[model samples]
Target: MRAAGAQRGRVKRARLADVDPSLIRPALAGLVPYEPGKPVEEVQRELGLERVVKLASNEGPYGPFPAALEAIERATLELNRYPDGGAYRLGQALAERYGVRFEEITVCAGADAIIGYLSLATLGPGDEAVTGWPSFPSYVLDPLKVGGTPVRVPLERGRFDLEAILAAVTPRTKLVFIAAPNNPTGTTNTRAELDAYFAAVPPHVLTVLDQAYFEYVDDPDYPDGIAEYAKAGRRVLVLRTFSKIFGLAGLRVGYGVGSEEVVTAIAKVRRAFDVASVGQEAALASLGDHGEIERRRIANREAMALLTQTIRGAGLDFAGPAVGNFLFVEVGDDAETMHGALLRKGVVVRPLGPFGAPDALRITAGTPEEIDFLSKTLSDVVPAFR
Candidate 1:
């Protein structure tokens, strides 16, 4: 009996040894997984700290709008059943808000999830997707996940170079991702630049405008992607999120607006019930309160101003003309060192190593009290690095 058991164990070992990595997609080779900002709870646990202010992720410093919280609380009771796979109510609300047809909208887990749907629906082996470097990693990542080539156009002055993006386009290019009010840098492409982009870019390529931070944008020249694209009547998908200004980052609700055909294609590849019931409810509630949206937008602008002032007072170099809820500060060669020091002090900011800027930090505009704490922490820490 012992000999028989030994033989069986050997057989199992042999089977395990025979497993090949090639069984998985070849595209995953050397792909580093996306690293989100460290959570507040995590820092608290690791360091045994009582208070940790997380300004790492570009989430709103405030909680979900009061109405949204009420919606979420009420919706929790309905969690025993699966979510509405179609996300009908939220879709209708977004369609009405954007002035687009219901068929033109597709809801997702988050705006980032839409990128996957686009990649699955459009990209194939050897197909090219063009995007700006250091903008959003998902723009580059999703294409690579589907065995597609990613053409990375370097940003000119921390902003998307529309001409360079146009130059990068080839006949093989199938998708283009433009992050308006781009992450990390918080810079936006102007109306004139986009008009030039749309006019010149070929119709065969699908342009995805990721407006994740659209609600917080106060710049007069910042183009409304949906309105502009609709006027052009081209292959365009404009993505928006409830995560930023709506303060529903935990719920992961986002929607995309495009032509019926484009939205249909993206929806076809999406998972059923990709968004949660509570998330849909909260998002729906968020849209109903337009006044709250404006108030939060105004608050975010003031917080961003305070953050800018704090950074300037510290005598640090930074990138600007930023209209989003964050600032990109140059922290010298030892950015990792500075990042660690700040983390120890219970203040969290995004270090841009994976975003390809190893010498900088992306600091979100946190609440006034949080910002004050961060300011004091930076004063203590920056002198050492400087």
Candidate 2:
């Protein structure tokens, strides 16, 4: 039996050697892939638990809009037909809503795809891309994939340090990615700060303002990042997604709006017919359902409030004044341990250890019942750790 096991290991190693070593990018050969949240079915199977509430991905607790569902159903019969390569109708819809020309918009499989395309289009072996640490991993990974150095500026007091990011830019800097109402922390920058940062950025470097959670923001002071900065003639690309607020994450639709020149350049790097027909139709339909979208925003606000109150009741420290559909809580213990415990209890939340916050967990706002389950699970598990 021992001899058989050793022979099997040798055969596996030999198979690995047969792979074309050059086909793999040197930078990505050993790099770990992004670890997404565990699927609900997988958790149920692993833990032998029937009831699982997942508040990990910052997805809409209220599912997709009714109109979007109807549109998707309508498009199902046309699956054999190819999606519009230009995404003309979706572009027109976004342009009409934002008061921009259709030529200035480009749709992608998701916002992450746009980020990768932008990095490939602008960044190179000797270039540098600047962004804040603990914002989003893609901002760093995309640049690195293109052989560009990722210059990370530490956030100040849990917020993006605009001045520091501006100071980090040099002749080698090719791109900048700023997440408005940043992920994991759920904080946003003010208009004054953005104005100052925009003014300081050189015209040669492209700036990407990510507004994935923009619709959930109710704060008047939360800088209208795209509308304000892009209109001011800055070389900025504004990225928005249907995945979050519209509840079309499964469909994978996102769009980028910017100057015609910037959009055109990024479009060159996009794969052919990348955006699917159903994704385009769903996003278009979602735009017409203003009432439903507003209700989702209200639901998110109430859920966040409940989460905040629960966190305080548990005697935990949490970052708030969030404009997004999630809150970051400091568990004051190893986040991985808490995440594991919650998983065992049929509740799943994101651990922020990968984002450099080992003591924090990013909790998405879910339905009231789901949120209650999360709170109760945490209440039971936290004290034991203490």
Estimate every model's Cα lDDT from 0 to 1. 0.89, 0.86
Question: Clashing residue pairs, candidate 1?
Answer: none
Model 2: lDDT equals 0.86
RMSD of each: 5.6, 3.3
Per-model TM-score on C-alpha atoms: 0.94, 0.94
lDDT of 1: 0.89
As a whole number from 0 to 100, the lDDT of residue 217 in candidate 2 is: 90
Which stretches in model 2 have alpha-carbon errors above 4 Å? 1-17
Model 1 Cα lDDT, one tens digit per residue, 64-147: 999999999999999999999999999998888878889999999999999998898999999999988887888888889999
Model 2 lDDT tens row, 1-386:
35544542353233433666788778675455677888898889777899999989888876678888899999999999999998999999889988889999989999988998889888888799999978788888888887888999998878789899989999999888898888879998888888888888898888899999989998887776667878778889999999998999988999998989878888898998989999999999998888988888888889888988877777778775777988888886677888899899998999986676778998898899998998889789889777
Model 2 worst lDDT window (10 residues): 8-17
